[model samples]
Target: MIIIIAGIGRIGYTLAKSLCDKGHDIVLIDSDKEICNKVSAEIDALIIHGDCTKTKTLEEAGIEDADIYIAVTGKEEVNLMSSLLAKSYGVDKTIARISEIEYKDVFERLGVDVVVSPELIAANYIEKLIDRPGILDLTIIGRGEAEILEFIIPEKSKVAYKKIKDLGRPQDYLIIAIYEGSELKIPSGDIELKPGDRVLVLVKKDAVDIIRKMFLE
Candidate 1:
């Protein structure tokens, strides 16, 4: 995929590096010459030194052929404008990083494919950590309406030593994978769950509270 990223700050740099490592073509736009130079030295990606919101700069960054365009500059206006311009330039996807939660509706109405709020996400993550002590990890899917959660089976849990088939196949969630010691396996109906086994479950958002009571309690 050809991805164009505006800004090379901490968030942008980390995301660009990760995507580049996955063998995707990346082009970065930033007004800071030093930051661009620093990133150019560290990664194999094209760096453009110019205002990302400018049409000429975006054209030079090959925006017309870009599969994804992400704006993560410190300034919210710049990010929103860059994303809007990228979409106008026919970029397949446009994503903007916004600091203020209130600006989300306007950005969405302006045709930004996605709006990400780092602060809000961090706050929610912290809240989840405090609320669900037994949850190992949580990944929101389908616009936060569902989740893929990683958890460990406790020794005293009722489900321990029980075959998955006997549970009548949980209607609200699906056990996707299991990690027994060092081995990871896709769970089957007849598989017996053991204490301390790490499991991955895809669950409906509304059913999370009930599932937690059944397994984590």
Candidate 2:
């Protein structure tokens, strides 16, 4: 996928690097010439040194063919306007990072596909960690209908040394993958749970409590 990212600050630069590492085509825009020149040489991406809110600048960054348009400048106005222009040009998806939580609903209503509040997301992650001490990670998927969770099996746990097919409420959850000592393995009925194995599972939203009690508690 070709992704056009406006603003090459910390967030934008990090995102570009990750996507570029994944073999996605990336185009980056920013007003700082030195930063653009530096990143252009270091990262495998097309860098445009211009204001993204301008039509000429966005066109230079190949907005017309961008599969994903992301606006994440520190300033909200620039991010909003650039995303709007990208959407008008029929970009397949548009994402904007907003500092203000109040504008999230309004931005989505105006045709922005996604509005992200970094602060809120971070806070929620911290709260989840505090509430669920054993859950390594949690991602709410399908808009709350399902979830993807990561957990590391503890020694002497009830599920340890058990086969995948013997887990509690297997009908309500799917063991997708397992991470064991730097290796990732696809789960199957014959796979046995072991201590310190990091497991990734997808489950129905309502099954989270049950699974937590079975493995985490």
Top candidate, metric lDDT: 1
List per-prediction Cα lDDT, in the order shown: 0.90, 0.90
lDDT of 1 at 108: 96
Q: Summarize candidate 1's per-residue lDDT along 10-124 as a digit string, tens digits.
A: 9999999999999999999999999889889998999999999899999999999999999999999999999999999888899999999999999999999899999999999
The window of 10 residues in a row where model 1 has the poorest summed lDDT is 208-217
User: How well does candidate 2 score on lDDT at residue 127?
Assistant: 87
TM-score of each: 0.93, 0.84
Model 2: lDDT equals: 0.90
Weakest 10 consecutive residues, lDDT, candidate 2?
A: 208-217
User: Could you tell me which residue pairs clash in candidate 2?
Assistant: none
